[model samples]
Target: MRQRPVNLMDNPHADRVKRVAQLAGRSAVRNRRQQFLAEGPQSATEAIRAHLGFLKLSEPAQQMWPVGETVAEVYYTQRLIISHPDLFALVQQLPAHVFVAETSDQVLQAMSDAVVHQGIVAVVNMPPHSLQPSPGAELVAGIVRVQDPGNVGTIIRVADASGADYALATAGTVDIYNPKAVRSTAGSLFHLPVYTRVELGTFVASFQGRIFAADGYGTRVLDQTDSGMLNGPTAWLFGNEGQGLNDDELRLADQRVAVPLYGLAESLNVATAATICLYSSAMAQRRQDPSTS
Candidate 1:
């Protein structure tokens, strides 16, 4: 005999439900369990799609899904109401490794990091990050200490859109996999490769080409700098959100280039500055080798 899927609507306080909810606020639990919650439909969907190396089974959803040897499970609450139309069809087509659960809206809210969860939450395994330079990488993004989850997620989205090779989120940066940050990514988290907790100086020293720092008051402006400098393999270093890059970090860069500001606005935000810098380099690289595009 086989086990049938159970509908969970009234058991918000169940041991299993509480365990999944722990991933939302507790890093220690996440670390111990080696998993983080991917809240909402877009993130939950992509969490299954990305095939992020290893996944563990949630005891509840295990019988219906979590089929593979390593076993991957995704918990979906209120989505059980409408997922049958599309999301369910999508997951059905995916490998049996993907497991889903149908639960109450209350359970989804409980598992979410936010007050409003968009009716889905997934506990996804965190992949191990390796920080080596991207092979044949044209442009790279390096993030250090910048603490805002939204900024970090947006910067990654920009880097992906601008066609940067890869990104390194240094030690002090907020958790890239945090539920709020994952929501901010809006699916780009699966599109881009983001390596975490890298050391700034060691990475810069080993990089094959020039490294540039985006600074507010630097000796060179984006347009003033030679286009040739942007053509080669490059790394762009962005620093702490408020204080900006420290002296030691700036010294690691081959150059510090500032984006021109004509408006009354005091300065540029890190994500905006990073987008401009990455686009400038990407366009320059495209010009250098038209066929590369």
Candidate 2:
């Protein structure tokens, strides 16, 4: 029998409500439940799109999925009507199995960690992608111990927009799934393949593509980068926010390329620097084949 939309407003302390809310704070809850809360309309839209193959890397993690469990669910506040037409329209396109529940404002707050809720949250059924590179993936981004979650999320967005094949985050980098990080992504989290908790040195050693380390004080300026170097597969390495890439890490890359600072600015934001680096590789790759460009 098909299920009907349920109204859940009475008990704010119900086990389900409490459990879902805990997802924002506890990684243990997310792992055990195999469901993470995507609070607000932006995350909801992206989480739904992930169901539609926005998450290409997730497919390989399906072995951990329980049997007969293709269905997913979404919850929202019926009383708290939002004027976001685009968000609602995206929700409507999802399959019928994604249940929508009507809840009160108090309940919505309990289910979200954000200071403000957009009256909607989607319970995304997602699996953790392993740190394996896809075949024929040329352009890759490597992130070191960038502790800031917002920077981590925004870098993923930069990778997605710059046509990077995938992103590999080494150990010590912030967890991509952390609620604050997820919120900062603004849906770019679901757009590209992201593999986390990797060993930077080990991965760099085996990478067949040219590795361009992003160093502000490096010898070669980005504009001076050779066209031939960009034509081949490439990997861009990014270091932490405070201390940049260590000596050992820098030695692993094929070349250390810096983005020239014309003005008096001391440095570029990690995400902004990464955006420029990724796009540089992307543009060069496209120039190698302009018909498709």
Candidate 3:
């Protein structure tokens, strides 16, 4: 059958589509080096329909956006509040966006990291954490000298799931909104607050809780601490993965603890150690909690 070649004009919106593509493709329209996109609902909808990958859906507002099958990830939450559950329900099923943000547009925009500020942003929720520990809140995590976004986000997730409270990242730690850190948190960034400080020594001094450092050759064993002083409100300190803790920082700790490693590996990753330390405290606290007991 000899038929006329179909014109893209037959699609009617072809020109508009081409313009949108041009806008999306241009570096200025997207973002340049060192600049990222903080998209709003308008941008999110556009991207969802456009099907761009690598967008890590964060918290709160991201949780509310509707996503298509082309989404890179969708991290949803039971904590999300919506007047239209059915509408959001559809967003939940999509595979693209990581449903993490709250319902506010302004917040979503603030958390957005891209240069364009897509109006809809990926915000990792840092739940309010108190210095004062609850009866059940026995475990604590602190970040010292680590400044990478990936490291911080990974540590935050490990700490939260391990049931740690009051994550204290020292003065040198990366800003939580560095995009890379927020993305690394997965959906766990929405779980707890990580405190940033201008001074490491003074910050730990102010912390009234028990302090322990995760060192390779420390005098104490992490596994044994569960039966010892770890049962109390404890803060587990993690040093930079490369340099470990400085001598001055080590002096600030009430105890220097080590994770028992039977394997040939030299030491555990700071994030992984943090998880172990936090969960150890959490398990002890859970066992001690009057209600749970």
Candidate 4:
């Protein structure tokens, strides 16, 4: 007996109605549907460029593409009805393999999470990242037990801005693929390399340079720390917001520095602290260089 192929083009309206009527959470999107949501034009662009294998594209994003040009294959929507033409035009020229959808709502609902879905979303083939340490890349940011996706994405953005080679996240950290995290980076997710692991202390010890840990309670202030101490390749370890650095992890630090709180606030958010620390280190490195100025 021969089985007939089901046409996606057939009964398009019914397919769309069903998808819009039923939607699931972001986490469930991966497990139940075997798909995860990557929102915003920029994130969608990065995921496409990375060749992470985006399964489909939403209707409203048919025209909007990234700025620069690259030849990469991706599944994209064909119907081009965009309110923002300029933005859409830029996205149109990218290296995309287009797929005309049966209906907009079906594609929209299939890719969206809890938050309002950006006009564009992609179902990407998620690659499992390795936790092993890298060679020759000395500058590192260790996020231990930071739970929020927004904070995690912000830190990754700061790390990329500071030219840090890669980020190492410990167990109990937020899911890096969370839509909120992906959005907060504003496309910095593509610029940085990230990894997750259970053992941070062992990884930090393996690196060659000064190990600095950021803590709110530390007596040594970030500004007051000897600038020369960060001269060599450095690894900066930042901890959780509410609990601060765990006792065993703190023991690995060669220098523990604190960001001073001038106002009534008890402590800075983990992401904010990461931005300051990474920039300060970058400044120190720049000052040491002759050609940068």
Q: Which should have the higher lDDT, number 2 or number 3?
A: 2
lDDT of 4: 0.62
Which candidate number maximizes lDDT? 2
Please estimate how well model 3 matches the true structure, expressed as its whole-model Cα lDDT.
Answer: 0.53
Q: For model 3, how does the per-residue alpha-carbon lDDT over 1-293 read when each residue is reduced to its tens digit? A: 11221222223234432332332233343222212222334323333433322344423223322223323322122222243354244344344234332323333323334444332332212222222222233566788877667788788778767756546667666555455565566545434545555366665666667878888778888767655576777777889888888888889889999988878998888877777777777778777776965
Superposition TM-score, candidate 3 onto the true structure: 0.57
**Which residue pairs collide in model 1, if any?**
none
1-293: candidate 2 lDDT, tens digit per residue: 23435676657798877877888886666767767767777777767655644444444333323222322666677643457666565556666666767777788888888998778877766555454655456688888888888999888888878878778888788777778887887877666667777887777767777888899989999988888877788988999999878898899988999998989999998888998889988888998988868
**Residue runs of model 3 more than 4 Å from their true location after superposition:** 1-120, 123-137
lDDT of 2 at 91: 58
Which of the predicted structures, 3 or 4, would earn the higher TM-score when compared with the native?
A: 4
Q: Write down the RMSD of all candidates, one decimal each.
A: 5.8, 3.3, 12.3, 7.8
Q: Which ten residues in a row are the worst by lDDT in model 2? A: 62-71
- Ranked by TM-score from best down, the candidates are 2, 1, 4, 3
TM-score of every model? 0.86, 0.86, 0.57, 0.75
Clash pairs detected, candidate 2: none
Q: Which stretches of candidate 1 lie over 4 Å from their true place?
A: 1-5, 52-71, 78-84, 94-97, 130-136
Off by over 4 Å in 2: 1-4, 52-71, 79-82, 89-99, 129-131
Q: For every model in order, what is the number of clashing pairs?
A: 0, 0, 29, 4
User: After best superposition, candidate 4 residue 95: deviation in angstroms?
Assistant: 6.3
